[model samples]
Target: MFVDLLIGGIFAMSLLPLTTGYCAYSYGRSFWLWFALGVFLPIVSYFILFALILRQQLDHGQRLLTEAKAILAEAEEAERVQREER
Candidate 1:
């Protein structure tokens, strides 16, 4: 009975890190690093992963904003040229 309980406990402990590694892999991140982090520092690893995802989103938003500003500037320049011609 004691041996069975020990095996079950080990399985339970390993499951979380495995799941975390899989999540990192699915997100195109480093699987082994997350797995090790999850094993040693589960909560911290999750926070770090979330922060990375948020940073990527922020970068994408900044790129889109820059593109929009450039397009608007081009449109304004064209309008100004049209006014001069008139």
Candidate 2:
């Protein structure tokens, strides 16, 4: 029974790379990176990918915030200039 279980587990592990690669592709990440990680460390790769995706989203949000701040500053400056002219 132990040997059979081990064999089954190994078989399941071998298929992990395919699923990981597909997920990476869907997320616009590097499929090969996740695929290689899945082969060597399948469980850890999932969490790593999740963290990486979250970090990317956070960086994008930060950039948008920065842009908004700049636009608001520009608009405020323009309003001040108009007020001074009146």
Candidate 3:
């Protein structure tokens, strides 16, 4: 059972080349670049793809902060306009 699962997992990993190709295409990058790398280095290519998808913790927090500030600013402006019209 374990060996079967392992084999299946490896087979799924082998298909990363296709996923990488599609991702490259969607991102307007060179599909052949990742495709060839994945074909030649399946394990390394998996890590490469993983790295590409990683988001920095700081960046995520910063984006949330920026969005929150924008929302707050808009609400404040609406409140100020209501006060001025009265």
Q: How far is candidate 2 from the true structure (C-alpha RMSD, Å)?
A: 12.2
List candidate 1 stretches off by more than 4 Å: 61-86
lDDT (Cα atoms) of all candidates against the true structure: 0.84, 0.84, 0.77
TM-score of model number 3: 0.43
**What is the lDDT, from 0 to 100, of the residue 10 in candidate 3?**
78
- TM-score, every prediction: 0.59, 0.50, 0.43
Alpha carbon deviation, residue 48, candidate 1 (Å)? 1.6
- Residue-level lDDT for 83 in candidate 1: 100
Of candidate 2, the 10-residue stretch with the lowest lDDT total is 49-58
Clashing pairs in 1: none
Error of 3 at 61 (Å): 12
Per-residue alpha-carbon lDDT of candidate 2 for residues 56-75, written as tens digits (9 for 90 to 100): 66897866876797899999
Candidate 3 local lDDT, residue 57: 23
Clashing pairs for model 3 are none
TM-score ranking of the models: 1, 2, 3
Q: Give the better candidate number (1 or 3) by lDDT.
A: 1
- The regions of model 2 sitting more than 4 angstroms off are 1-11, 62-86
RMSD of each: 11.9, 12.2, 9.6
Model 3 per-residue lDDT tens digits across residues 12-73 = 86697877877766645688988888888877876776666454324788568767978999
